[model samples]
Target: MDYSHVRGVDPAVADALEGEVDRQQNTLAMIASENHVSEAVMQAQGSALTNKYAEGYPGERYYAGCEFANDVELLAIDRAKELWGAEHVNVQPHSGTQANMGVYLAMLDPGDKILSLELSHGGHLSHGHPANFTGKTYDVEQYEVDPETGYIDYETLAEQAEAFDPDIVVSGYSAYPRAVDWERIQDVAESVDAYHLADIAHITGLVAAGVHPSPVGVADFVTGSTHKTIRAGRGGIIMCGEEHAKAIDNAVFPGAQGGPLMHNVAGKAVGFNEALQPEFTEYAERTVANARALADTFSQHGLEVVSGGTDNHLVLVDLRPSHPDTTGKDVEEALEEAGIVLNANTVPGETRSAFNPSGIRAGTPALTTRGFDEEATREVGELIVRIVDDYDDQETIDAVAEDVQALCDAHPLYD
Candidate 1:
């Protein structure tokens, strides 16, 4: 059962896998949409179903011998529906971006207008980034938060929606610290007769746990990754209201992608079942608690967190004041040397480019799942502050690596 051990694979790939596992166990993972899956989820993903070529949806496969695959897909769909109260669930999209694409393909025509959050303001690239297919194919109108408050301005969003009269209004984010107002988005979309798509990929687990409001009941379509806070296999799912159910399913199968990964679907089923447990609600609460703990630490160190602080699992640290001369990229590399994993992000309408940004983003969902509580988050935050402050010194970086290892060792993964 020691699947984490990497003793008998191709040396190059094995070495890389082992190295990744070692890095994970030694460092702290704070990426907002990332987490370590349970051993059971992992096992399910790597199961024999991967070898089977079950093209198309469950029973109506292009190929034969898909009886078991049908059961797996049904389980994933049923469990996800039960957990999130979705009328229809599609467990076929390979990733969140793909899931969103499926929804777009199902509902909109080419050149149709899509109103979404600006990418720099915590929105995903798939939403409307110029270089992405969505931007190239559809007319994009983006909205952002108030520059001073660092929160979405519903009035501005409504104005933009009216001006654009978009076919779809996207409501979601990747790096935003607070909860989005789904009702406001729904109202705006309704006023314009646009479909409301809630990309609740980051906070899906919280929504399922009732810690955050579920957009399933209000939004026309909802897309989420099963792996992030849900702690499932690496895949995406799209949930929607009853009216769009059949269209969404057909779009995912015959339109966008051909086959569903049955094994990953099985893993998703397990993850959804786990989320349905009472303990998952407790875990979600701890995730928020840990985020707050880290946010306090960042504030103590004089780093400005966007929206004052986080209302969820991720916190966006504005390192502008902390290191006026340094960039977010510089701080990110320095922190990586100290065995802390995070991403550099851009504030809304930021002057910096994507390669090197002005902000650092971290989260608590992964660490909290590893059994890290408020005290541990504080320690990790202290490490982050120390690394950022002493980034210029090689000796300090080395010392912090030792500290990171010590903390990681204290909570060894899967041991």
Candidate 2:
């Protein structure tokens, strides 16, 4: 974690950088939206390409001296197209929100209706949270998962679409743990003459690896984060049919953002190329397997695993059923003290406020990236149950902390 050059220039910032590395190395990162990228990706993200300013697409850049930048961007675009089979790909959006913004910019006008899943029901802010620009800019309505089944009620969603008569119907999700029926969502969109935007931000790698069903062909617009399960750089990507290529491209650049992050694009190119390999398929599969193991372990420990289980790389645990007295925040804080990191999330039919929700969301991507298999992930889940069951006990916390350290030691990271 030496930052000699940065140390001389700004010691304060350099110290925080080293601390962050140490933190990632020592802790269990179960955050669903995060994954550990490879050394090659880190190197590419830290390259000199950051100094370049490529404002436009490959052949029609507004700036001069973009030969290498063009090469990296073109490679990323090609790899993305091959990975997802989208007719057109845009690798320029700085984040997933911007990616959604691009789609909205291309296909919608102010006050146009947007029907999407509700935030508390596992949708993202970009899908039209009141705090976000989308909610304010567009007339928004939201759908939800079936409280009984913990899955999207496609029939109800379709009915809502008919009533709303939206311009766009948004699919995919942020905290959802099951497979999406893209065909079902597309049918709803078609029946109402609405474009569908599927946000595969969390399951990008799973979809690319053919583990989860992809919405690329079914939805009119598909958006994803470059990192998460895919191991790409921290950025965003948009994919659509050739019919809307220019609209998407122009919307992403001039409509949503300025110059692209060329260094991140280079890193994305490297990561996408890595995903194209056969090993990534194994990694993707193991990620879901580990999550299933974790969910099984938690359920065996008497915690209510949401949806009865998970078919993806994450599990949402609603604490209200088992630990009726405990909030998700209680378990989350206690787990962090014992070196198991995850987030407290809002569950479907949430009774509590967003700040401290009723459920906790845990993921296996980062742990799987650190070489954890089903057994290891199951062990981690057991450790979580211990902390959640005895959060106030210092001895329990310390004992669990030791076990967490052993796991981190057994499968070291950033070495």
Best by TM-score: 2
Scored by CA lDDT, what does every candidate get? 0.88, 0.94
Report the lDDT tens digits of candidate 1 across residue range 174-229.
98889878998999999999999999889989999988888988999999988999
Model 2 regions more than 4 Å off: none
List the lowest-lDDT window of 10 residues for candidate 2: 322-331
**List of clashing residue pairs for candidate 2:** none
Model 1 spans > 4 angstroms off: 1-9
Put down candidate 2 lDDT per residue, 84-176, tens digits, no spaces. 999999999998989999999999999999999999989999999999999999999999999878988899999999999999999988988
